[model samples]
Target: MPFSARLFCRPPRAARSRRSLSTRISAGVTALGLAAVTAPALVLLAPAPQAAALPNGLAATPPMGWNDWNSFGCNVTEQKVKSVADFMVTSGLAAAGYSYVDIDDCWMSGSRDSGGHLVPDPAKFPDGISGTAAYVHSKGLKLGIYESAGTKTCAGYPGSLGHEQADANSFASWGVDLLKYDNCNGDGTSPQQRDTTMRDALARTGRSILYSLCEWGQDNVWTWGAGVGNMWRTTGDINDSFGSMLSIFHANVQLAAYAGPGGWNDPDMLEVGNGGMSFTEDRSEFSLWAEMAAPLIAGNDLPGSSAATLSLLGNRDVIAVDQDSLGKQGTQISSAGGLDVLTKPLANGDRAVVLFNENAGAATISTTAAAVGLPASSGYTLNNLWSHVKTTSSGAISATVPGHGSVMYRVSTGSSTTTGTTHPLVGASSNRCLDAFNNQTAPGTKIEIWDCNGGANQQVTSTASGELRLYGGTQCLDATGGGTSTGTAVELWTCNGGANQQWRLNADGSVTGVQSGLCLDVTGGDQASGNVNGTALELWTCNGGANQQWRLG
Candidate 1:
């Protein structure tokens, strides 16, 4: 079995939560949170209201690059930022998609100008933000600035509190492409109000700058972050320590459903290459971020970073998963003895799994394909992400993970489907999800695959009872009255939790009825796409046919 926040930022006392995650979870994840923490509710509310989708399409994936916070902090200056920008380009981080060179708190003047607009501290930046932005752009990297939603930034710089529009206009005039808005000194402001104000102001500037909400998840920002910014910090500031990184990962992993194309749940900046962690721990940090589909913004001094750190930041395969078009976050499937299995479904029928050993010494971890949401009948092509080694395996995958280290694998099921935690179940061979037969709800309707869309007919779910439940209640994929023979019709029927309704996801990528001992297969073994998309599905022999391979991402 495998499965897996304390905020330490300096701030007003009330902004801190006494909660230290004292509960030691004995088992695995249940629902959206750990079993023990569910009663009090870890996340306070539902996602931001539907109307709050903001920032248009920028920061669609986790923003990747380097920020000055973890390394230089308030010591960041014009030369320092420019040097990092140069390193990003020279070290191939920019070419590898790490574009934003951001300056965190303390980059601004202590007070706004007499005109009530933000002004960069000339002593530090030398060139104003506009000129700095131009230099960054000339190097093919984006420029990011920091400010607070409150009256003052954490480092005592003038915040954007009362000058939202004016400051927004100034940033746009300076060609800023990213904004990391913090929440310190926000006297009477709700995270929502302040973030929303800036969001509106950014839009007014007519520049598509990526808005980052740094509220530290105090106000249930995910419930409304989409309405405010492209990515929102889901945790407090991260220290360059394994414990700190682990706490943040736990707090944000289960919030996957709240993340998608336009908005993301940020776990804060990367601490890799920083001196606080061993290289093994650093790899674990990078692996976890990629697993969460979180931003890969490196926080180390790029110039001083070792070659190993650069390689970790530039691993195109791990980056691919973080930047996958599907934009789904990975969830922990199991946890025990400090070993965790987290799975992220990819754009194709591929799955990325990380076996993280959090113990003080090395540990052996194993996870069955089904546990990672892979069908039992299908074989997977696996690539050890860190080693760049590829292999194939069926049944289950296992590894001896180093202490405080991780092994990540990108697995492709050969076929693809959209049936995911909230999306429809797609038949790998059919390129569609299992839908209600003829779009019917009554019992005994033929279940088939159709082009996935808003129609509830295509939606499916995997339940604890092992039923392929249709979106609507009362109906599920049934075995046509306990039939076990090949070619038995699989139809929609009242969900009675009967053996005929019980299905086991197999290694062969087929759903087998526990009672019938047969696999779910497309009629006539159709691997053909297009017009025959809505082909009927039935119970058939598990002969490892392409039509029997089903995947849910």
Candidate 2:
């Protein structure tokens, strides 16, 4: 997790030593040669059985809460934690969905008891950890405990290296609802192994603790974290700076393919209340994290937070996207001129889109429904997540975004088609319908006309890029063999996401390819039902003939 930049930050408590620069370089060269010999045969490990699922199906969506790491750090105590929980309720954070009050490092005594059980520092937590957990739970919030997989924590305190079961059982006895297992001072196991051990131990204790793997981003955690924990950090600790926040966002967004219901790519705790960033940057940070379906954990002091910080942290409209239940992380659709557009598909065919501008000042960014992967012919209703404003969208939406700020929208597709409907095409001349050949799905399947049967094979749906999908499959209406000739058959083929597959649904009911200036037509203006299937559909002149007239719902 933190082994790269943070591993050697301080020497081990008992392994004190130093080396000259030449000696260090010499050792590095030797280690490089050893690594070269062993790197290719890397051991691909899966989680070791016990950590496979949440104890009782927790974290169906990303976890939302407040942790003490960024704000209080080693200064965390029972009183401060209780105060934070009080603030969580009074400031409307708990009502807005925050539920956990986490204690970071330095809560344990320097030495374990004779029985080797961790002892809470009496100087800080006079009521002990169990008492603190009771206090937190009484305020209607859950408690999260922190531990390291190593022999000693980053702060040189007792860690859970050889005491996985003991620590897990103790946390369970203390009523821990979440466990943030960190990586420091190793006890000879790989990060994966270490994390899995604790997960298995948690299972043994019969507690439904939400496991959060905070090994930083080491060992490519996204690849295997789903089987190990509910969420895993995809970056090192985030500092209260624009660069740290942006870098973490970029790193986590690129690994979205590995995230889903049981697992997520964490970008560390929130820096919103830390006070180094402007309001615009703070809003962008939270908005983008929600867009990416990241865990919504606040790592700030809620007791003394300003109204701006509380507002940014407790915005439910933005939080809804993160907890959408579909759990699909947004993807970057396009980036240019310091603006980026991302889209995430939600349940029931709705989509959430974010237009972000990171330029020096406010800039106008615009995107068409097609660009963001919405059906081209249908109309959508757009709702701004931040402003709670709703409006109708014809085909495109544009807004002026302040620097380091974004405009978010939830778009419902196919709700505003003309005549308030969506159906298949019907040829006016032949009185037949365009259908996939024999309801077959394969390359070069010719699109022909048959009697309207109200079957799925005959239906057409517009795509975000203007492509008309064939038979609700990956195949799109294509120009046979990419032809530009006058008589090329309109056939179905696997969509290559190209201009040849894109079509424009003109208000005159003409379906024309964006690249080719040809119209979808019935061959030779055939009128007979039998002749409709016998003759092929072709690209022809854009005349308003009865053969060319069709219905597109």
Candidate 3:
């Protein structure tokens, strides 16, 4: 069935209470009893908040807990689950809201009950799912189950391919509070079909369950994910290495527009506290996840976490971004080499900007009001989320991030008593640039750095209106007639405002032209400081090389 048509099938409501029929003699007795009953009247009522419609439309934030597949895979057992639950309460994880004890694939046996209901692996979960749910709930936690939308799950277990309603009803009856609906062996050709099938199943369950869609992003799930599930995996499974995490982190920037209240772009799960990455990289990963508004489902053994892991997990300021009511996902405002800057608007009108350095070598990343689409010369207060420090500045904000590290800040409008005069012509001094090298300037003339006199020659503007303009003039330093490729001379052209001339200054110091999608290259490929002007300029690959690195003063 079509997705829209299936969404209209609401769960059937429970039967209403009805008055009982009594014998004729009972009516006479009721008349005499009415006098006795008239002496007093009593009523009973239940005060429930309609299950509090899951936080972020899920059951909780900072989705505390673990997934077995990452560490133990299919070797999970009832004993191990119980031990983990015990440890959760004893190790203070439960208090921190890590309540869901989810069992991934392989917990299913090869058969169903006589009634055609899916059965748990009796050898592993001897007491069945109800017993497990009761045990987990007794510890002040909830139970989660995993299934696939295909004929077989990733671990080759039975999936709900054509049995959406049956599986949904079975889960609802099992007291499953969370469902990790995966896409493993389903028909890849039809995402709409897969989405409709799973959504219909969940909607008919008549129970409020946290639906985590794991279809990756093949079908632009971000656009239609909310109606199908509370959260959808924005990428494939991430490994426990820094490279994997970095790749996944950098990829989600494009999907930021789809994340908001009641829906999230899941970047798989947290690999922190899993003893995989260095302390620095692990912290960076945590901070990045929070800033990106990604779900924080810890995939490690919470019961066995070390002090460092606990500290990283307990950072309230970082958590605030993920739990922010605005639910805005961060997007890459600028990137050069492995360094990038991402920004997300917070509920308090403040913006959370994270400077990330993904390269092996150390690199500096800086951002100004103009680069981030904010007004230049405007005073702002920055509160570093990780360090919990406040910095006051006027004009621009810049920071140097270490290799494979990140610095996150909450920026807001505020008064700064300390104001310094900005350099007039030192656009380079301020880390701002007017034009690329050898950019066409009347053909014969080469692009050269001149004093910031606010003249036509010095003016550089961006495709985004009111953002990233040259220091002085309305004329923007543009790619010479929207030229593309090497030797294309950049020039101070009129702000026809074409996308080719439009540029985005990445947090990592790389400048990208909107139209050509190329980085600004220095002329003659010179990397030495103070390379004289009149050099041939052109576009080149962005490698954080010294030649491509330009500072905005």
Model 1 misplaced stretches (Cα beyond 4 Å): 1-52, 376-378, 414-553
The residue-by-residue lDDT of candidate 3 on 424-455, one tens digit each, is 21221122234433334443344555434444
What does candidate 2 score in Cα RMSD to the true structure?
19.8
lDDT of every predicted structure (CA atoms): 0.74, 0.73, 0.62
Candidate number with greatest TM-score = 1
Candidate 2 per-residue lDDT, tens place, 185-229, comes to 665456789999998999888889999997766666677788889
Residue-level lDDT tens digits of model 1 in 65-129? 88887787677899988998998888788888899998887787777778898878899988988
Judged by whole-model lDDT over C-alpha atoms, candidate 3 comes out at: 0.62
Q: Comparing candidate 1 with candidate 3, which one achieves the higher lDDT?
A: 1
The regions of model 3 sitting more than 4 angstroms off are 1-65, 89-97, 187-189, 369-379, 415-553
Task: Give the TM-score comparing model 2 with the true structure, all chains together.
Answer: 0.67
